[model samples]
Target: MSQREQAILVVSASTDVIDLIFDLCEQCQEASLRLLVVRNTDEVESVLEHHEISLAIVDCSTFTDVEYLNQLAAHLSPMSTMALLEEGTAEGMVAVLRNGADDVFSLAELHLHPQLFIGSLQRQLQRVRMIEEVRFLRESLERSLDELKADQHAAQQLQEKLLPPPVRELNHIDFEYVLQPSLLLSGDFVDSIAINEYQTIFYLADVSGHGASSALVTVLLKNMTYRLVRNYNRNSSFDIQSPLATLHRVNRELLLTGLGKHLTMFIGLIDERDSSLTYAVGGHHPMPVLAQGGEVAFLEGRGMPIGLFEKPVFDERRIALDPTYSITLFSDGILEVAEGDSLDEKEQVLLAACGGKNLSPQSICDFIIPAGRVNPDDVAIMTVSRV
Candidate 1:
């Protein structure tokens, strides 16, 4: 196989300097030096455009003007500049170096240190190749990122369409909740549907994973929840009006799909007649902390997470809803928050944020999610208030 050739751009105003540069570049063991001789500095830019030129040798002996040298250095970038200086032009040599020369070579040094000159030229060529490679890779990465963003937008639109509204109005009471995904899309899904005039069933499910894969399952969950709730609400002679059964069913549906997916959920049934709350949870974290009148405690129920085992049993728990209590549920991404000067310290800081009075779900999330808590995963939070 033929090794790829390395290119060098020799820009000189003097015939003698041009000759020296060509000799040095050609003598180098593995360089394809191309002579780009221009009497004027303006021509350097045009020649650079035509050739896959890497290292640039600017002959100071050819041009008395320093501005042209500056322009050449600026256009060529820093990786490929070699300034040729006359015997007494120390000031000019310094100026070229300041502008952005890789190395300034004297006429005598070019003659005596032929190997050194060739080595410098080869290094410049290598540097230019590296720069070009990095530029190509960066542009490719940016293009990939743009395509990903477009796909993410489409996924978000699909997920939003699948979600029921944040708040649903019922006959005797109104249900309101808020959901925020840590990433472009979240695994958290919430829905509310009317079963009867006096009773409504609602639940929040946090699917495992983030991004597109986690988001696809949301559509299925939304359809299944609405259908089951609506069907149950229509029948009056139903004894299984509990959150555990709902989660159990959701688990089965998820498992049957064979997508290797699972979810942690808090499903609830609210009876408007006595303001009673019945709910079940499935291996979820940051358990619903029900708070009222400055008192807060974690809500708990027993159930294996959906889709883990073939047939899992769930426990349904009941609570009395007073005027000021609120229910909060969250995904694991919240626990994975980053903060502090280093980032990991912020997670510990959130522990303090969760402690206090007059705590609402939104408040807890806001305190924990600072501007710098950008990890690669998704975070989600949802809440329902009984007012």
Candidate 2:
């Protein structure tokens, strides 16, 4: 049965009036009616607490004041109400409607014909059920969205744990980095690990896209890097320091599964003994300028990105590290910043940030990043310096 046709509630202030409604409710054939005689405002709250009242047939003859009627309307639920009125002015009828009554019934007409009252009450109850159903659905959707948001937050935290945190005081090298994700799970990833006592390796990679899918690929890359590093330690032929060979292996593995996947990456290994830095690029953005004494020089890569073409030649670039120079490896998101007058303008701003007399990696990043571009895509920046 419809919720409207299940049960009803009858409210009246006077004992005689209550008895009259109880008798009429018994006579009605449509649905069952539950009667509650509310002597005053004190009983309204108590009655509502225990009983699931659907429709209220309020006694309007005794509860005639606007304030009392308004109190009942305010305490009751919205969208389902039936007002009882005496044969009076049109203003009284309008007042009942303005107070949120679905329909106002005349007491005289109700006594003259019982069928009309039953039919009108039944119609109002049907409307009440419809509104209740909509309200139920809306609440359910809100709860589901809240749960999804909470799950996403948990996933983001787990993804962060997978990322390698910055290592402080790595022998003779001074480094700093920043990672800002556009979404809860970012596609950009960075890591720094020591290959041996004399060589420390670092790589910055941007997956093909953003969000959870790209984040999963980044986790896979990290695991692969870990496995390869271990292999290099155990065997002499792995060439752990060769960035090009690493990219080639990663590219082949990603393409084998036909995942339509690819990555832009820059991998670097620092030889602490001679301060020589060997690096390779995989279709990543051009390297940042190596800034020294207010001058800038290009550090361009000579290879295509990984996972695009098979047997792609990976070119490794090397530079002798200078205590006076800073080597920056960054994602395209920084260069793609939209607020600048031009790409040159953005580059100039970044160069100026690094131009500070006592600049650190964190300080330089903080200066160059505009407020508006803080997050729109994954932005990762890493700088390596010879201390």
Clash pairs of candidate 1? 182-379
Per-residue lDDT for 37-124 in model 1, tens only?
7777677668777776666777776677767777777877855778887773677678888877778888888998878888887777
Off by over 4 Å in 2: 1-8, 13-41, 51-54, 108-123, 236-239, 255-262, 292-295, 307-314, 371-374
**Over the stretch 246-307, how does candidate 2's per-residue lDDT look in tens digits?**
89878988888677768888888888788788888888774665766456665767678888
**Maximum-lDDT candidate:** 2
Enumerate clash totals for all models, in the order shown: 1, 2
- Can you give the TM-score per candidate against the true fold? 0.69, 0.81
Q: Flag regions of model 1 displaced more than 4 Å.
A: 1-7, 16-20, 29-34, 48-53, 86-99, 107-113, 195-199, 208-220, 223-242, 253-261, 270-278, 285-300, 317-387
Evaluated against the true structure, the overall lDDT of model 2 is: 0.73
Number of residue pairs clashing in candidate 2, backbone atoms closer than 3 angstroms, sequence gap of 3 or more or interchain: 2
